[model samples]
Target chain A: MIRRFGSSQVSALLVGLVAVAAFAATYGFDPVPDGLPGLGAVEFPRLVCLLLAGMAVLLFLQESPPHDPETAPPIGRDAWMIFAACLAAVPLMATIGMLGTIAVFLVVAGRLWGETRWPLLVGVSLGMTAVIWLVFVKIFRLTLPGGWLFGG
Target chain B: MEAFLGGLAILLDPYVMLMVLLGTVLGIFVGALPGISGSTTIALLLPMTISMGPVPAICFLGAIYCAANFGGSITAIMVNAPGDPSASATALEGFKMAEKGQAGLALGMSAISSAIGGIVSIVVLIFAAPLLARAAYSFGPPEYFALALFGLSMCAAIGGDSALKNLMAAALGLLIATVGMDLTTGVERYAFGVMELSDGIGFVPVLIGLFAVGEMLDQATRRFGKPAIIALDAARVPGMAEMRKCWRSIWIGSGIGTFIGALPALGATTAALIGYNETKRWSKHQHEFGHGSIEGVAGPEAANNAAVGGSMVPTLALGIPGSATTAIILAGLIVQGVRPGPHLFTEQPTLLYAVFASMLAANIFYLVMGLTMAKFFARISLIPPAFLWPSVFALSLIGAYGPNQSMGDVWVMLAAGVVGLLFRRAGFSPAPLIMGLVLGGMVEETLKQSLLIFGDDLTGFLHRPIAMTLIVVTLAGLSWPLVARLLRGVRGARA
Candidate 1:
């Protein structure tokens, strides 16, 4: 039972529920104000929030199945580092646009992934930056920000 | 018939044909990338496609959708990871084939089955859509509500071993759907007072954050080292005997896909799983299913491709989305000023024909692209998680923010990513939740409309012949699982 409702899963669910409730409370009972005119007409995003909350509850209530902890693969420090890096990326991307952030992120990330050749790392990072810019900006013509530091 | 020919003439225009070809090739590359679903590719391309002529845009999008469904299998076959949810079943056998140095054969089978499924679905759609629309128009509000009920009920059919969780997820979706302003009363239920909350949450950011960013985070947390890329064998095509063995699974998969695709909410993943399980039940070596049987690869690949065609039925005929990708496609239709419904055929026969021809054109392109690009696409699995995760993260951010040029959407994407990560850790799928959110509004509106029209008389709900038939069908569908379980229990007791 302890294994099923591990500290990680429980805390995650609790956090999610609290966040959802807070989001709901921020606007009071009237969640959507600009909704299309009529009674009971719902839109997609609000529905997603509600579903996520419900899923959190359901997940919390679920009885944990038994498992042998020893047999499961070890969650290594390296994995955690990767997780930390991913989490940190949101803030970094917010500060720097895709090209600058990704270039730096890739070089560091590539080394973490066990790439030994510095030249390969630089080459790959530059190549990826070019491709993303060309495809998303040049070919597709989608608006991708370049941050305040560089002209978008 | 004449309309179809005219549409075909338009599709045959060199520029349109070129767009279809280019779209299919691009789709294969995107689909080959792990965690890049067909829907995301379409969403990303949508801004650009908006400017193109409607027929060409439809053709390009159709080609992309069809080819991407097959393209995901390339990575699944060459590596253990599924490129998209629909290819998850294929990865079981396909990756095993790669492990055994038969990667080429697995790739060949997936390509062939996908092509067959795509072509068959197009043929079915070309004929079945008009009839379905005609019958659906005979439906009153009550019947439409019943149809929504049927779609919602199928949520129970998704994922592994948790009908309760799926129901809970869907209910949560429906409840959240109520947060926006009440269409009838103009009162908001859960918005609090935030101005942004007034319009409700946007779909693109949420989708990008949940699926793209969430997936990258999950990949980051994996304990094992990434799968090593096996050296490519230049020539390793399947033998005739292997093709003969998989033919049965392919046909069964395609049939299941077409059937489920026609249903409003079931989508491709459901069809693929059902097809995979059904084929396994009929196979001589059923025990080998998850252990990497070729039948498993063939069935799922076929079903998923066919589902692409199947999911389009409602979108084209009724202006309803049968899946997430179709929902996005519906948005595109609205952007192009084409209102899809019962009157579409009469009001715009050439447009209808154009859509049909585009579907056919996409199928042919899928076959060509899948065959030529399989080996190259297979290489995507080798990119280290460090590089892959950050890049995908960047794309997720850009894609989420691109729609409205809002930094707020980017933050929303971040929040959704966190939520998505939590859902993954708890072993609950976010797919059904996402699907429910996309479909929830449509379902609720139809139900309320029906109730308003019928007043307090419950039996009046079934006054329409089509409505009565749909309600009965929905009831039967809901009871199917319980009935099957009971039968199994009874047989076991006797034994």
Candidate 2:
């Protein structure tokens, strides 16, 4: 039988409900018009809640198993490292033009993906970055961030 | 006809032609790259194109949208990585063909089918839009609400998983859409005093975050999976024999895509999915599916391309975006001081014609580029995930921030990425949410207007033939699956 109370569904339901309730508590007023036909924003959320509640009930009754742990795909080690590094890069991207950010990301990615040949990897990565950079800057005239180092 | 010829003349000018070709080539390259989608490509380019003549810019963006929609299939087939979600189904069969050393044939089939679907859709759009616009001229709010309801119901009915879930997602989307100021009452509903929330979350940021960043997170989880080693050789174009095999699928899929695209709120992804499902349902060898069936590739690729064309219909005829990308494109049009409603055809016939011409030209360019670049683009599949994910993630941020140059948008991307990941884990498809957001305002505004006109009597919908027709069709659409399931159950019981 499917486990409806799996952590994922429970979390989603909780977050979604909390979000709705927070909105209601903060901005909501009582006496939302009753017997309102399905028209306008006033009626829309009421219907939405009915639908969500019904879905929650359906989830409870379904026979699907919680995600099968045995068949679960591995969250690769390299992916985690890359994700962490990329998150670090988001704030820095404004200082570095897209090309610069791409260059660093490519080099890091190549290493993490286990490309032994650095020369080929770096060459292709930089080549693509340069092409995109030149196109955006020269042809399209869109100004990508000029990294602090590049001095525009 | 004279207007069409005049429009054609304007599109054929050397400058317009050059831009179309350039846009098509650029679109193909960008689309072939993983992590970049047609919407981002257009968003990045639209700002630059704004200063140019609007006709040329429309033509340029048109080419990009058309070619990019087709270009995504290249990565899908070669690397088993879909460059865009629309091409995900294509990868199912296209990647299998590559595994079987038929990468060239697969590429060729996709190119031809994409070209055919694109051309057919443009033709239909060119002819059908004017007629539809004429019909829409008589439509008031009730008609529009009925139309939007029909569209939303179609998504709920046809979504592959539970109808309840799709409705929930769409309902949630509609609710989220209402979180800003109420247009009628001029009072805030859910903004909670956040000024940014007052604008109600700009569409571009939300889209980039949900679709693009969410996609990256999903891809990141697969980082450790074994990469497929495609034996890269000169990719061959599919021979005429194979083309003939999938021609029927291409036609049916294109028709399906165009029809779905013509529907408000439905996008290329929906069309592609529906086409793929329908192809599998109708095929004699459904068992061969999920294992590199050529029909699988042809059907989805065709549908998506056609859907691109289909989406333009509402934008031009009714000022509504049929899909997210088109919605962005519509915003771009408005930024350029062009109105994209039915008035556009009468007011800006040359621009409309130019768009049509660019769409037609994009197909030709897509065919040419796909044939020549198949071998070269296939090499991208071999690029490792470490480098790929970071670069893609970075690009997603840049693309997300490009439209308005807002930092808030970047945060939106991050939040959307997290939310998207949560939704994915919870087995919720983001497609319905997208449909809901795109159509939500229209549903609200239209329903409000309809109620003002009809005064709480929904039976007023039956007074209008077109509205009544849509309502009937929506009911049929919702019930078809249930009826089919019931018949299947009866047969199983007898067995």
Candidate 3:
């Protein structure tokens, strides 16, 4: 029960901090231009921030019910690993080309999800990447990021 | 009548017909995949619309929007995986029917009822849009301000677990919307010296991040296990007896759906939930609810599909989106240089009527296609999440990067995906946030303009009857949850 309440409290605190940051950010905003009448840009955002802060307090005051352990599973290490691997592809795509990066990312993602058949993994990854490339890059004519490795 | 014929003529063109058919097929495929929403599909497809004519583009997107609503029920009924949040209510009784070897019956009921509901709502749209557009012409900034406030209040009321949390999420979204240069004063608000941030966050990238990548992240954490393989009995279309039994629920759901969908900020998810509850309450066989009731499947399925047509009314007439999918469609219209307002009805009657005709055609096509392909669509749920989600992730990346061809947008998508995952884990919903983001600019501009007109006397707004009434409605809506809780407590104490 305390753990559940703690989570709620943490979220409320985060919300409150965001509200404060929003209010604080208003200090940097230039004043409404001369001759412009009634309620500057800062006023509405400031009002929203105050309301947000008040709601954050109200949210904190409300007691959160205990979570059912059976239903709420703990985040596992593998999930974090997968998330990190996915995020890593962002930078990697800039190094390797789009098609190459996607091919590698899919194979790695499939492996992480417990698909161990190398032939199946390679075929699916390369096949899907090619199709997406052909459709999006070729047919749609939308520009995709071509990395330095591709000499674009 | 001439304008309607011109619209029909445009749709009769082979190219436009092909686009509509392709869009419907794509919509069904995407909607059958769990966690891939129709709005996300539209966001991904928005760039492709640039090459097409305005009529065919809007018509194609409209067909997808209409068909996707019905297609979501396919998986929801078969394997209990709701392809969209709006299909959750359908999944409750639908999976039960599947367990009882009546999957075909449930699917058939949903498909037929959806067609009925959609057709009814389309008829309403055809009649109501012109009237609504005329009324909308009289609306000034004050009225628009009040309308936006009411819409935002409804978002808090209908979304997430708690109203306070929803408000906070909306506030966050509003703050995010203020990131670029302030439109009013010609001064930058929160660009933080980044060149890319000057244009504000790209809408498509953020949408793809929130809906597609966020869902992928959530799916990654869960164990796939083995797919539930229910042996589908013969594809049994519901007979006239079954249809007759469900007609009342279908009509009631359609009515509720059409009314709610015409209201700003309330989407198909809320409509489906309310429709399910109302149908159960009025049902003669109420005990059959949650235990394979045909009415249960019909109610939500009909309501959700009906909402697709109903949502188009405000999008076309008032320049306000009634749902997220319509919001993206509105963006598509704006991109096509077709502003959605009263002028659209007057100036682009052919385009407007084409959209209406396409929706009608899509509804008829979906009924035929759905009945024929119900079993095949059901098999889609049997695919492992392991393989499916990775492809979704890949597609999300391409979608985020496609529009601007910018790595900056990709980074924004990644960051937004993280924020989305955190929001989900904390019991806060992204729906209200999305609503805030979509409405934020309109709210700010209208409020400023209203204030300029009123000249520091905020109470002067009370003189405007429509604006005042909407403000009052917003206040009541915001307070009703608290008032209901207090009344419940008092009743409990007295008892």
| Candidate 3 positional error at B368, Å | 1.3
Interface RMSD after interface superposition, each candidate: 5.4, 4.7, 1.8
Better of 1 and 3 by TM-score: 3
Model 1 stretches with alpha carbons more than 4 Å out:
A1-62, A67-98, A108-119, B13-15, B39-57, B91-102, B234-247, B280-297, B324-328, B331-340, B347-352, B456-459, B468-495
TM-score of chain B of 3: 0.95
Tens digit per residue, CA lDDT, model 1, B285-318: 7877766688888898899989988888887887
- Candidate 2 residue B266 Cα shift, in angstroms, is 4.6
> Could you tell which candidate, 1 or 2, scores higher by DockQ?
2
Task: Provide the overall lDDT of each model, using Cα atoms, as 2-decimal numbers.
Answer: 0.71, 0.74, 0.82
User: What's the C-alpha lDDT at position B494 in model 3?
Assistant: 100
Interface RMSD after interface superposition, model 1: 5.4
lDDT of 3 by residue, A71-110 (tens): 2357787778779878998999888867778888888888
Order of quality (lDDT):
3, 2, 1
After superposition, candidate 2 runs with Cα above 4 Å error: A1-4, A15-19, A22-57, A64-152, B13-15, B34-54, B80-102, B157-161, B224-250, B264-304, B319-339, B456-459, B479-495
Candidate 2 predicts chain B with a TM-score of: 0.85
Candidate 3 residues lying further than 4 Å off, grouped into runs, are: A1-5, A68-72, B489-495
